[model samples]
Target chain A: MAFSLDTVIYMDNNATTRIAPEVLDAMMPYLSDYYGNPSSMHTFGGQVGEAVTQARQSVADLLGADPGEIVFTSCGTESDSTAIFSALRTYPEKNHVVTTRVEHPAVKNLCDNLETLTGRKYHISRLPVAEDGTLDIERYKECLTDETAIVSVMWANNETGVLFPVEEMAKIAKERGILFHTDAVQAVGKIPINLKDSTIDMLSLSGHKLHAPKGIGVLYVRKGTPFVPFLNGGHQEKGRRGGTENVASIIGLGKACELAAAMMDEENTRVRALRDKLEKGLLSSVPKAILNGHPEKRLPNTANISFEYVEGEAILLMMNQHNICASSGSACTSGSLEPSHVLRAMGVPFTAAHGSIRFSLSVYNTEEEVDFILEKMPPIIARLRELSPFWEED
Target chain B: MWEYTDKVQEHFTNPKNVGEIKNASGTGNVGSIACGDALRLTIQVDENDIITDAKFKTFGCASAIASSSMLTEMLKGMKLEDAKNLTNDDIAQALGGLPKEKMHCSVMGREALEAAIADYTGVMLPMAQGEVVCECFGVTDLEIIRAIKENSLASVEEITNFTKAGGGCGKCEGRLAALLVESTDKQSSPATAQKKKKRMTALEKIKKIEEVIEREIKPTLKKDDGDIQLIDVDGDFVTVSLRGTCAGCYSSQTTLKEYVEKKLREQVLDTLIVEEDK
Candidate 1:
């Protein structure tokens, strides 16, 4: 069995990705050689601290944000927690929070835990998502009440990869004097994010989800936003997050950010082309596959689709056998008996929900990999459907 | 992801007897567009009532495809009687095992088989005899009972997987619970009948079920911001209703199978299987 060099495709970029060698190279020195704590008052520590500051500037430079606004946390989840909790704490007078039904589990689960998380009464309105997985701006506007503390929406969805009208949302929130936060984990790397151009109060981004290591993230809090720290221990992160910095990871994240700044062109061109190839090939090759998510307004590297009658996990497992990695929207994959909220919120039929699969590409992916996936995917779907009971009747 | 058994993965990867058989003698189709899973089974029986070929098409998760594949493989050389006797549990067992949640996949196999049999015989499926229970799956009484009797289903979830019953908005869970009780009672009643009757009258089952609902069940659930509406009563059959917040609650299946069935089994009959009014 001969395999071509081009056949290895890594389509699941949204889950996580391989750290760029350059980012790893930038981090190794901090990991092994410069072991002194950044807080220690010595040349050795001061140098490392300066490097952290430089790294902060590198991250800020990419987002069109100020270095002081970038608060490095452990991961995107932590950043999300910080942004959401900070909003609620800062505006205790406001009892309501506004979010979308299609947010990632980090946000969705927190919303679900609001009753337990808050000691007092707090109301949260999970705005409905449209059939294409985008939040209805009109409905989102309608949901904003005078007592709303925050309007938290992700800039781009992780599952559907559907881009939200975040600027409009932030503007609406600002007009009402409500703070806005966005879980921009998926958007920061793939899309052009200019903080100077938007009224977003707090935005969250993760490192590993980009090319950096797992335990690093950036929470961009625009200069004068009402902020209360979610963590309380010391004066680290300017009383934002309290912890000894993960210096190596932070450096890696900074380097990754720099690489992202350099690679934004490839994302819009090569990565998008590959994604389109993968999407178009799968849809055309397969008999009854339907693409999920917004057609034109989604992440360049992500494509969610449903192969009418075949379940997603089944396809993922089949793909796993060939080392062809992918993901699914089946309840079996989400650890809930129900399907992914993102797909369900879009009102995808139940018969189609289990069959949903997500193919998220990245700059690292090759054209040959897309073709290989194109070759393997339709057959997998075809085989699965053949055994499908629905297929039998039809 | 679920802690899927190795057995489950194997069938998912290499499903057997996939594709539709042209001019197949009978086809069984079960589940619906909303239930999230649908299975179709086609069989070509030779002159001897021996299945010469079986092909399946399924629209669902891995467990479903694997179950249908396994069912097709299992039935290819078997007689129709054995296939009729086959339950969802059997299909899962044949595949080594499945996740507890995926146990319904095997039940879908059995359902598709029964539907195919009904289509082949041009007879009404026993499931078609009662009201549709799971609005999401379009499951009926006969389907639920057959699932219970064949798989020894004891929970709402088990019924859901096999027949897609009580897997939707869950309004019918109360009715499904009542059905479980009624069927189980019928199964366990023959010996108690000193009158030498092969089965209890549908009237007797309904009366006993109503008495149990009025005495033991209705008052408790109603207090918890839930209400039960009894929909129908037929031979060895009883249908109750779920109202208020319970009607729209997702865990209605739990209340129906766990609370309702437990009550009916305690007061009415031991082997009863509840079916929702679709």
Candidate 2:
């Protein structure tokens, strides 16, 4: 299954990125020679523990947070769960949570089952989003109350790549004495974040999303945030998380974060341009192709477009023939009768939601790859539209 | 990913028999845009009741489009009676089986085929006469019951997977669960009851009435921020009180009779009568 860059145009970076070669090289020592337990009371293990500490520092520097605040976990989903569970345990009197309706299932499903988690009834206020996939901040503020334990929102939507004003929202939550957690798995590397100047109590980031390998994630806790351990086994992660360290992935993620900090400008400039060109090309060439998220206030590397009358899964399968990788919000792709919850929450019309395609770029994507996708997308869409019963030539 | 079979992929990629047949003998349409899928089927039947030609147009996902394409292919040259008897499972098997969640797409195909046959024959199908149970999908009680009985479905989730009922806002889950229990009970009992109308003991009637009240009546009402409480049961006369938001609503009587009473009579016994306790 080894694929060459020449053979495939990988535009699904928002789903997961190809591991950076430098990150792999940095992780090799830990994977092979330096495999001693980080907690062992010996020099060999002490060296590994020092590597872990430096990795923590690198991740902290990337987010502009204190090194002590970064606690590594298995993935973004686990980090999200830990943050909310910690807040709920810390504030035992509160029995309500506020979040957006468009959150990834990691947070949405967790909030939906909070009663089971806490063994008591808990109310959840899911703020609705506008057609542009942006939240109504006024509605979000209205949802906060004395019974609200925490407000969990994603920094950037995974489906639409629409950025939320989490910094402002977090500040509002702080003024109300409510803990705030942001799932920044999609936002951490794609945007500039300086948590030192922000009131976000907890932030989650996944490694594989930004050129690191999978199985490594960071949950940042502001220095004085009240905390309780989600995992209560061994006293690892300063008793905040109880599992043994995922050492190799930790090192890889540190390298990835350092690289992300170095390439932030290029990502905004070059990757952003590629994304725009692909979007514009598809919209102009393909009939009934519409953009999904907010026009300007979105991630630079992501573009979601919907081709009416054609199904997204069918469009993606056609793209697969050209080795062009992308994702869709189509019901067929999900194996469910409905499309992505994000699109449905946005009130995107039924005709468009079923055909939405998400193309997320990375620093690795090229102008050539963008052109290739632009070249291939129009005819594929036209062909499917011809097959579609609803499609009519204009 | 759905792990679609090779047959499914072939049908989805290069779907056959697309577009509408001109001067079709019969046509059937099912689903809606808001429901996320729709199909329009056309067929030309000869004087001998043989399908001479078939065509389809679909607006849906892969399985939906493929289901439509597969249905048209299955209908061409098929006898009208044989086509009328086609089941959703038959459509799925034709395409080497759809995903469990996508079974509803096949069900849509079968339903559209039945509708088209009805259109040609000028006879109303039983489903048209059945009460609407799932507003989201326009699935009827007869359709849900048929799917459950044919597939031996035991849960609301299974019913959703098979028929797309309760898959939307989920306001119909209680009704779906009741239908599941009802269908399962009918299957377990012998056909002698349907022929002889067996009588039940007083305790048996009370237990059956209470079970329907708790399982079928309360949940569907609770979704609308309403509740129902059983007051007393004596012989065929059952009394209940509407609590919560349902207590003073103008439609409480209608809810009591149309929904509560209808469900009790269907599930417990046909002679059972429900009265609102003022």
lDDT of 1 at A341: 77
Which candidate comes out best when scored by lDDT? 2
lDDT (10s digit) by residue, model 2, range A39-104: 999999999999999999999999999999999999999999999999888888776788888998
> What tens digits encode model 1's per-residue C-alpha lDDT throughout A77-156?
99998998998989887777888878888898897678588876455677777798877777677667677888889999
Worst 10 residues of 2 chain A by lDDT: A120-129
- Estimate the TM-score of every prediction: 0.76, 0.84
lDDT of 2 by residue, B1-278 (tens): 56678888888878999888888999998887667778889999999999999998887777888888898888888998899789999989999998888889899899889888889999988786666767667777778888988777888998998888888657578767766776788554222222433235466778888888788778899998998888787545687778889987867656876788889888877766575554
Q: How well does model 1 score by local distance difference test?
A: 0.80
Q: Model 1 segments beyond 4 Å from truth?
A: A1-7, A349-352, A389-394, B1-14, B19-26, B44-52, B79-81, B117-278
Q: In order, what lDDT does every prediction score?
A: 0.80, 0.86
